[model samples]
Target: MGDKTDPNTTKIIHPVYIVANIQNKVRILDGKKVTYSSWVKLFKLHACGYKVLSHIDGTTPPAKTDEDYESWSEIDAIVLQWIYGTLSDDLLTRVLEPDSIAYEAWTRIQNIFLNNKGSRAADLEHEFNNLTLRAMPSLEDYC
Candidate 1:
């Protein structure tokens, strides 16, 4: 995304960060020079349904057949949801008692898979299982 400028209107700015991977490792680009506001915006946008892709040395991602990018995108979305949802739930649970309305809302969101109980539930569960298998300590650990 490129920066845009307008003279007449007030602007809501989003902080941009270059996310890159190197030598099979992922890291934020120019991390030290990033401002706190930018950092917060970067994270907020990421939390709010933005997709961030990783690049190495400005090159296209390592190649795979059609199977790779599609799977990566789905996993990326699930991982992002898990990170943001977990943190939000933790904060809500700590600040509001379990019986509080806010806590109930959080609980409901977390249990959305169960409440929906349809193809969506099956899809999420399948993705979760695949992710769990991939994240296992070893190939023999889980299958």
Candidate 2:
């Protein structure tokens, strides 16, 4: 679907509209503590390929035609590769054991990082309560 021909070469050139091969090495997630910063980096990495996790997870159905299916499968494979390559070894084991669709695997990763357990919630609450605004010479400095 993403091919072009140059007048000089008559050979098909695949446009790098989606993820570039070089970008495939963006950043590997360590899976120690899932933070928004890392999640955003990973999200942008996939977004560059137009491989939105929601769509891949079947929030939208697969195309009905064989050709469409082939295209979808190719994209899915790219996503699968990126996902597998980025996760840490421990996270990889968790992700692999489920034997799930790409979307589900992605979701599992998100859940591992994003889920707010009671302990975490309480810790945040404690931190919030203990926070204090230091005196500042100016309003701008306080801000």
Specify the highest-lDDT model's number. Answer: 2
What is the C-alpha lDDT profile of model 1 across 26-129, one tens digit per residue?
Answer: 22322235432353344445534333323111224324565576554444444333333334334334334332222233344345423555976587689776
Per-model TM against the reference: 0.19, 0.56
Name the 10 consecutive residues with the lowest summed lDDT in model 2. 13-22
Off by over 4 Å in 1: 1-67, 89-143
Clashes of each: 0, 0
Please, what are the lDDT tens digits per residue for candidate 2 over residues 79-138? 666676667787788777443556666777777767856777798799777655565566
Instruction: Give the lDDT of residue 61 in candidate 2.
Output: 43
Q: What is the C-alpha lDDT of each candidate?
A: 0.40, 0.61
Query: 72 in model 1: Cα distance from truth in Å?
Result: 0.6
After TM-score superposition, what is the CA distance of residue 114 in candidate 1 from its true location, in Å? 35
Off by over 4 Å in 2: 1-25, 33-37, 49-58, 63-66, 97-99, 123-143
